[model samples]
Target: MIRHDTPSLMLLWSLLALSQAASAAPDTELTPIEVTASPIPSVAPLEGQDYSASRVDADGLAVFGGPAQANPYRALDLMPSVNLTGVDAYGLSVDQNAMRVRGIAASTYSNLAVTVNGTPSSVSAGRGGVGNLFDMENLESVTLWRGAQPADVGLGMGNLAGSLDLAIKGPTEEAGARLRTSVGGDGFHKLFGRIDTGTFNGGSSLFVSGSTSESDKWRGEGGQSRDTFNAGFAQTFGERGSLEIYAAHNRFHRDEYRPLTYAQSRDLDRYADLDYNADLTGVATTDADYYAYNSQHFDETNLLARFSWALTDDIQIRFSPYWLSNEGERRVGKTDKVMVIDIDQEQYGATAELVAELADQTLTLGYWTQRLSSMPPPMSQKVYAIDKQGGLVFSKWGILADMGDRAYESPYLQLSGERGRWRYGIGLRYLSFRIPGITSYDGSGLPNMSHDSALSMNPAVVAALSTDAVTLDEWLPTLSSRFELTPALDLKGAYGRSVGNPWMGPLYSVYMKNRKAFQKAGIPLQQLWDDLALETSDTIELGLEWRHGSLVLTPTLYYSDLSDKQVTAYDPAVGVSYLQSGVDAKAYGAELEASWGLDRHWTLIGSLSWNRNRLDDDIRAGSAAVLETSGNQVPDAPEWLAKLGAEFRYGNWNLTPIARYVGRRYGDALNQESVDDYATVDLNAVYRLGKVAGMQSLEIGMSVVNLFDADYISTIDVGQDDARPESIDYYPGAPRTLALSLSANF
Candidate 1:
């Protein structure tokens, strides 16, 4: 349950502790501390790193228009080789947004890993990261590492592309409080507040924050609301060590929206709701609205504990342990035969690192281990039937499906060292997964046989039964190096191999639903199992970085080869869907980013990326027809992306203007349907009032998005083979919108 008084209680407890510590300590003069840099640094490339990485600090984040509901990931859209869709004026709704790295598809984020304070945030069931759980108002920095990840970071299972890391802000040296409130278009309103407790005599500090936001749907009938709370405490144990603990809780609810077809968008109203259909029996005709009943609810909580100690003068050790839990439910479709999904998951992990100072080199060794268990039960219920008067009649309840227990154990080791101007690293990981049980209802609304009867009935059933735990393992390795030839120039290269495990949902569905059905239709179970394999990839890249007095430039070229790419196929003969490990695929790309200080008060930033991806061979379709997809562009993979922005600051005011462009893209593997290129512009301004009235700080900001009201497709449902205009699968982009916000700190 969401508690509005939780933040207040936490703040009260922190103050009480602070008072006691102060009363018990001696009266000693406080030492003065020197500050060298701003609390948040500007966006910059990582020096002495072999791979491509970019860091955006708090100041850098402000350049992205300072939306009321800030989303750190949205700021990465300006970076090279990154694509984002469905972003609104506030840059919120991370779950609704789709993010793509390089030429990879956005349906699943298994290729990318996301972390907060070294804790893994991605769901164990391949549903991307827990982005909605984070309180963006408390973030200090967000870093994006493209391509290969560092050896010491091993908190994810399937990280073939790279990782995104977010760090939270630390407590201030002096006690302070901040509050921000905003109202904008679409009935949008938000309230955010934070409190910081300065260090006490015992060298301890704490901070607590909370936020609540709600907004009406921009182009639909429904809306969304969210509540979040975050807290952190740190204690110092003299110069030997320190301990820090952080926790966050989030509750989110939203109504799902139905996508529109091209014909509906062009002929009917762009925001029309056509999600109503007649009953199957044709006995009573009433409004069976899909959108009216479609909704989702999520609750997530996370806790992390970090401990550091200097074992000796030459050695230091750090240990971090984290725990996370999530509970969610999604309801969709008609009221009569509504589909409901309940997911419950719990995960815990720890990472230990040791740094040793050696002659001419610094050696680092680390180990990471984590365990996850999840239970997802899906059911379809005939709650009620629609009547002629748009009323409902009651019906019976029955179970549809259930997955008993899913678990994973991941462990990895990392070793790296730096000597002089050359640096190198290596890493290895082993991943294991298991699923224990499953249950599904039959056509007559009766429960199927249990594990004993089902296994005895058919020998093949024994191998496919979910009750029999199955385990799969894989080993991953990576190597990278960097060379600094001059003070202003550096060369880097890396080779990495990564793996993507098959998702448990698809695996359970295929084994429980398709295996028996296919066997009844004369297909062997062994053939089905053999067709599924783990997805693997090998990537190689070379990069160059050149820095001048007031300008920084980086260009990188990379190539990747993928094998055993998992794809879904339908068997016409058996009327069942199954997974197939298709042939090899390849992708090559180039990315360039440049930042220049036009003058003392102005800065220019630009980025450009080009990439191509294609399959290496042809495959047979459901109708037993050979489709020549070799050398054809991958579905939904755009060819070009560009971004440019300029920032100007004078006195207490700053203004920013930004533009983005995306080239044409194919919607199908056969390149039959396509969407045209589009561009957008945005402008933002902020004014700061220092020590206004009795307040320590005050600021106001406004942003305008889609300045020209461009009409284009923001995203598309790929795999469409037809060329009919009505069959075009696309999601229309948002129109022009404006937002304003005000904040005060005391």
Candidate 2:
């Protein structure tokens, strides 16, 4: 669907054309400015990244505390253009947490990519908790890209919105041990320990860590529990080569919270305590609402390695390989029966790059490939029906498929250079996908439904479907440049194209539920499957950074034109929601961040962002009706966001407080069913104990979440942007909670 003569290309070329004229001017050397004081948890564009990027390190996570073993998304809540919502204060609920970047939700079709140490994790495909693998204590840095990313980065499934990468802190050079304990309201308890072997003979080190945590839901009868273990080993190979290997395992179980309707959100005092029934009524229909019947369990393990060597002083090569194993099950109590979904899958991938330094320029050739079990959900799910007596019966298969040559591959080349006051990079990447084909079977009528029993039973074949063997490929190009306009001022611009793989969640859902309807309407499922296309987005951005004395400021503006954007729309003939493409969208926004050191004891930070995302046109609702959805704002995308915070330091005591505001947003495509805006304040304070109890250092910390006891809607569960008002569900924000922790280092 993309053409070289499009206006998007014209606009990009016009801006890039200025680079040729500017390169002709004589280059001048500019002096760098030095700032003595800055805030502890600060956000600013990364230097030399050639994009709208920001990074936060360990110090930032320490100053902005909520949970001792917080997830990766929680660590990035302080960054600009990031909105994360969780039903619990500690971010313990894996299924209830949601994140959005630049008006695009992370779990749906409009999604961004997430990586761990520059490699994509299989758990990040859907609404999975991939961040739980490495907690804040083990993370070295988290980098965020809001616009265009370099060719060397990994884009899992999609990157139309943005991308985030978490870097792990490997084995330390010194031998030491650390211990931590925490206790909080609602029966919360956690313990963490780590031991580092330090560098020994011939430059080698090893480390291991483990944690156990549990917490009770504030407004429900159930709770959440989790256990995690991580280990790493590193060794140096002379002076030009090094190797490091890391492994992580995590398991968790949690009871889900009941969702409320629009009427319930209008009056919180009466419906605030509404939840799943604590005890079963014994009646088959009533027992379906039992709290214990609606829960989930997940267990995942990952192993990754990195190898690097220098063939020569000017040339180097690197390789990264990873393996993932995941298995889980979700049980939800329905009207008359309990539906259980079981999943088990595995994935393997690697990335290789060759770099050469030529004079003042650098050239890189990179290739990445992965053989995945499946796309997105990344699991073959089987559905079951359970009765009130706890007797399990096979109902139907949610999704069943074999790995038939399903793989992803990308090759890229980039050239970058810095000359005097100008820095520039040009790159091109080719992405190709080999979607798997699937076959459906009629299993509901079988007497024996176990995996082994069902195979021998040989249930009738219902239908065979697939995206065919067609290999979808796209050519994406990027251009970026940064110019030092003055000694203390710099200007930056970037242009790139990003794409998303076809979403199969809705497609499978509709096919399983309404296969007969397709036949009645004289439509072929194969035709519908073949019609799916990859979503694409073209973006352009301009920004500037200025520094003076003890203060720094950055402002940016960005525009994105999306083509064939995926959305779940209703099929009137079948009376169901299905995956649909070819929806055009336009998003434009502006962001600003500032930091100032007023004095030796006081440092302040603030940020503001505004986004306007809308549909460019309307589409057919049925055979004869038009939806009239043009010019409507995207659902759940808040237009305005603001954050303010300050840190105060005095001797051994340090205190920080921050407040965040999210503007109103709609729940449906027509801009109806609006949600109210809300603000919450959080505080963190830490005290150093110097040397005590024969330990090198000791510290005590206290954290307060939602300090004001704010009562507001935290997230909306509409399933899709085009959902009707009656189908909308809301989750209330948690009230004020307190947590205290103690740590010691030896």
For candidate 1, write residues 1-746 as lDDT tens digits.
11122333444344444434433534433222332322212666755567778877776676562465556767777888887777345555555566667776433235666677777764534332254566666888788777666655535656665677888787776887777767878777777777888998778999888777767666656666677788889888999998888888877666654566755544335444343342234233234444444566677889988899999988899898988887766555553444445555677888777887776556667666666665332333334455555454544333344344445555565556777887777777666655345545342322243323333443222333334345556666777887788999888888777665554455455655566677678765444444445567788889888888678789999998988776555567776545566668888899998888766667777889998778887755557565567887776678899998887766677778889999887766767666678999988888877665445666798877788988776766542221222444566666787778887666
CA-lDDT, candidates in order:
0.65, 0.73
Question: For candidate 2, lDDT tens digit of each residue in 498-573?
Answer: 8767776667667767877876776666666667777777889898888886677888899988888766666777
Candidate 2: deviation at residue 511, Å?
2.1
Off by over 4 Å in 2: 1-42, 108-110, 125-131, 374-405, 447-453, 464-467, 570-577, 623-625
TM-score of 2: 0.91
Top lDDT model: 2
